[model samples]
Target: MNQANFDEARKAEANYHNELYSDHEILEPGTWMSKPVPIVMELLERILQHKDHVTVLDLGCGAGRNTIPLAVRLKGTNSRVVGIDLLEEAIEKLRENSNKYDVADVIEARKGDAEQVDILEDAYDYIAACGCLEHVSSEEAFIKVLERMKMGTRLGGIHCITMNTDIQEVERETGRALETLIELNLPTEKAFSILEEVYDGWNVLDRKTTLLSIDEEKYEKPSQFRCQSITFAVQKI
Candidate 1:
């Protein structure tokens, strides 16, 4: 994408999320924010087995869908889940939801681009980026973010990433294809290849790709979206 197109895409995405967060309540049924990603919860269970205190970074953590639950799980321990998002409304809702969930004390919510967020070396026990990498500016930026995530993780730590690949969208009424505004929309195989290349020496605890379809309204029009969803979990050796 050119600079202008990239900026437009980012703005659209930010506006979409801002409106979504403002309109919906946290954990409201029939929404993607209704529950934390299962893989993230599963990996947290594994992390708790061997460690008492943990630190986690949740990229693109919209409205504390995963961050709040992770904090609740790690309650009573010296653990924290730092959540970052590009939308201001998301961060506000995340704070409110964290308070409502009684996990505010353990959550650090920040508004920032996931691609540009700082990930200090050996800083996190777990890192999660769910449904977010496609919002990055480019494939190069995506890979750079992954490298930062890898370096930020502590040894024996876990990373769970879920992203949409090979996305297709169409107008529901006319059956005409619509442009997908995401920045890093790679094919499933290509995305996996990049993951494998970046995490070459890490232990692959889980990896899978599944096709999914969803009907929704976007840009005030009904649309259908299909994509290969990739779920990857790895442990740093």
Candidate 2:
């Protein structure tokens, strides 16, 4: 994908999210909105069940689909979540909803590009990158982001990264778009191998890939749309 394609895809994503944000359907299921992936919610519930006063970083946290519930879960506790997204509107909406849900104190909304893998400050108890990794520019960027994530996590910190392979995208084969969405097209097999190698010495909590059904009303290709999502829930060793 050229710069135009990348920009257009990003614009589409932002517009889609903005639409859902306007409709209050970004967090719901079986609606004309983007539903939170099951694995994401599952891991979050587990995280909450495991810790109370934890610090979290939510990457690609568009409009607080994941951040809101997390903040609500951590409200009144010493826990905190720093939510980041590329779209300023999404972050703004996140801020609004955080207050609406009375979790403004717990959620810190900011705008940042996930592909940059920017770690602001402090070691996080948990880091979540749902629907974020494939947006990276290249395999090298992927490795870099994961390495930074590992380095930024506490010794026992957990990370939940959920993303689609290139198969899920029409423009890029491997979803490693550097400069543009067409910068690289990595194979799924090799991608997994790299991940395995990268985590060779770390504790692997959970890693899997599956094709999940999409809501037709919300997805353009619902008839044949399936999210070939890869999920990694790991702990820093």
Candidate 3:
């Protein structure tokens, strides 16, 4: 993606996250808001059940959207959660939420690109990358992240990841843009297809694809782009 598009995505992500967390409503099933609740609950429950106090690393943890809720639940545990994001603004929002929620001590938020998160490697018990990795410059770079993550995680750890799936309905513009990118060698299908190689040693605990509409009501304006979010979970065995 071009710098302008990249910047726009960052802005959109920040705006979306800010709105989602600042709201006080509990999302219920059968609604667009319910999309993340289930996955977050599953992640929270699994992390809490681990025998060892976890050292977590959340990749592309935009604006603490997932970090804060997860941190709130892990409050009493010995676990430590670190959220890392590529956008500086997203990091700022995370810090703001930490103070707003007063859980700064338990949740540490940092600004850095996950594609090169070298500071913490082979050091995490659970690593999560939600809706990330697809935007990497190249497929090889995307695969390289998993290799680094392996070195950073302990044996028998878990890696939870989510990304845009190959199957989706898109607006004419978005579809055209994606096709151009693919033609130029930015193979999103090829990129995510390598997940099998990246998590070769892990046990596939969850693997499913869900098709859902992007809640147009949730957005500030209507657009041609629609999306399908894919989620997968694996345990290092």
Q: Pick the candidate with the highest lDDT.
A: 1
lDDT by residue for model 1 (136-207), tens: 988899999999999999999999999999998889889898888777789999999999999999999999
Estimate candidate 2's RMSD in Å: 5.2
lDDT preference between candidates 1 and 3, better one: 1
Q: Name the best candidate (by TM-score).
A: 1
Q: Superposing all C-alpha atoms, what RMSD in Å does each candidate have to the true structure?
A: 1.1, 5.2, 4.7
Ranking by lDDT: 1, 2, 3
Q: How far out, in Å, is residue 82 in model 2?
A: 0.6
lDDT of 3: 0.64
Q: In model 3, which regions exceed 4 Å deviation?
A: 1-37, 167-192, 215-221
Error of 2 at 102 (Å): 1.0
lDDT, model 1, position 103: 89
| Global fold similarity of model 1 (TM-score) | 0.97
Cα-based lDDT at residue 212, candidate 1: 84
